[model samples]
Target: MSSQARRRSRGTLYLALCGLVLACLGFGAALWAQDHTTWFKRLRGGNAWSLTYQGDAVGGQGSALTIRYRFNPDSFKPAHRIEQLGRTHLPWSVHALVNTGEVARVEVEPEGHTVATCRILLDDVRVVAEGKSPAPGRPAVCDVTTSSTPEKWPR
Candidate 1:
């Protein structure tokens, strides 16, 4: 082959190799961003998380109760507090994000046979954890600490 033709072919091959390398790097970066950022999770679909409280006493006669729980990205902060649960509010449920190293807690005040059961669900299907407290006239506290991120959730 002519020297000019050989040089041109070599340059083309080098450019192609560079392009391939850049494509691989872009793919890897996309994966890393997906794992590390919430924007990517929103693009695909935010992780589905559900916290539920239920128990025998939930349906039975009981006085107004206090409920506390934590299901946010910030694990250092204290659990959110609410006082709307009562005899009529049995089987309370709410949806929120619960990342790894965080907790799903349900604390019901010791009110007239109050029993509290807590459940944490990921993707609306996977049961991450659950707990129950059934002692009457005693604080019914249920806690579940998650250890791992969901398969599709951002780390």
Candidate 2:
């Protein structure tokens, strides 16, 4: 090919490479948007706990665990035994109606419970307990306690 022809071919190749890079970047952005919203939800019904992960982007109804926690009116850490959890990345949550009333929270207390009690690694920092919001004038929010860490385990 002539010099001019070679230059044209090189330019075309460069453009193709740029296009591929842009496509890759777009795909990465989409994945990030989804991952940013990826989360787990658990709603408590007295003692029984229902847990589910948002496996999809748009919301679905919900999911139920085969092993349910059948306990009294409510109990914290009502997990079905550590062995029952199965290796998983899903976050663990529990809601209990202690004498504290609707005020229940989830925290990664010392698994052995020998270290501490009610040590909160709080999530939803922006909206704290129902009244204690992060905002200045508004009282912090309160209702439930939730926290999560990037750490995960594989099943």
* Each candidate's clash count: 0, 15
In candidate 2, clashing pairs total 15
The most accurate candidate by lDDT is: 1
Model 2, which residues run further than 4 Å from truth?
39-155
- The residue-by-residue lDDT of candidate 1 on 38-73, one tens digit each, is 655444543434444443255554543665655564
Worst 10 residues of 1 by lDDT: 74-83
Clashes of 1: 0
Would you list the C-alpha lDDT of every candidate in the order shown?
0.57, 0.31
The CA root-mean-square deviation of candidate 1, after full C-alpha superposition on the true structure, stands at: 6.0
In candidate 2, what are the lDDT values of residues 1-155, reduced to their tens digit? 89999999999999999999999999999898767642322233222222221111112222222112111253444332221222222123343222212233322212211221121122222223322113222211123422222222111
